[model samples]
Target: MEGIEGGGIGGYWWWAAASSAQLAWGINFYRKGYAGDSRFMPLKAFAVASLFVGATASAAVGILRASGVHSVEDAKEVGASIRSGLGIPRRARDE
Candidate 1:
């Protein structure tokens, strides 16, 4: 999909910014929960992990878009390359 422009913080940058904000919020909540009580620890931990994963994925997409990897195929290739670099095995896919 084409990125939205003209307005402030439009396009892929928006995703990155939002993701960063979410990560920050998650961390804050996690710290607060950790310091306050042990009952909410699991929920807080889950939130932090979820946000972190979202941020990572969003960052990757932002980087790919910024690098001119517009097509879906190109994005997939880039993801595969990253996975390979991280020693993650690729699953078989029907072309």
Candidate 2:
């Protein structure tokens, strides 16, 4: 769970690259009319949604890493604090 400050460049780089590639693929599929075809619409939509989620997660992780949050636990704490600040309800964890 090493972050940017911990020299975890490869992990973040991979996440960014993968997210960009997935988003591009999703956009390409939509532009090619794949979404217009009923058979392909569902799959295309799912792909696009998945890509967006991935990209969002990656960006969040990058931000947290850049802010000196190095471990997963620390990231979770920061996220929780953010959610609380925003008046968002915390999810129940099975811990």
Q: Candidate 1's residue-wise lDDT over 1-95, tens digit each? A: 45542233346777779778877877777666566478877876887889888878887777766676778887788889999999988878825
Model 1, TM vs. native? 0.55
Q: List residue ranges in candidate 1 displaced over 4 A.
A: 1-10, 33-39, 75-95
The worst-scoring run of ten residues by lDDT in candidate 1 lies at 1-10
The lDDT leader among the candidates is: 1
Residue lDDT tens for model 2, 47-87: 77787777778777665555668788887888899999999
What's the TM-score of every candidate structure? Answer: 0.55, 0.52
User: What lDDT score is found at residue 52 in candidate 1?
Assistant: 81
Counting clashing residue pairs in each candidate, in order, gives 0, 0
| Runs with alpha carbons beyond 4 Å of true place in candidate 2 | 1-11, 35-37, 71-95
Q: Model 2 clash pairs?
A: none
Q: Highest TM-score: give the candidate number.
A: 1
Candidate 1 lDDT at 65 equals 64
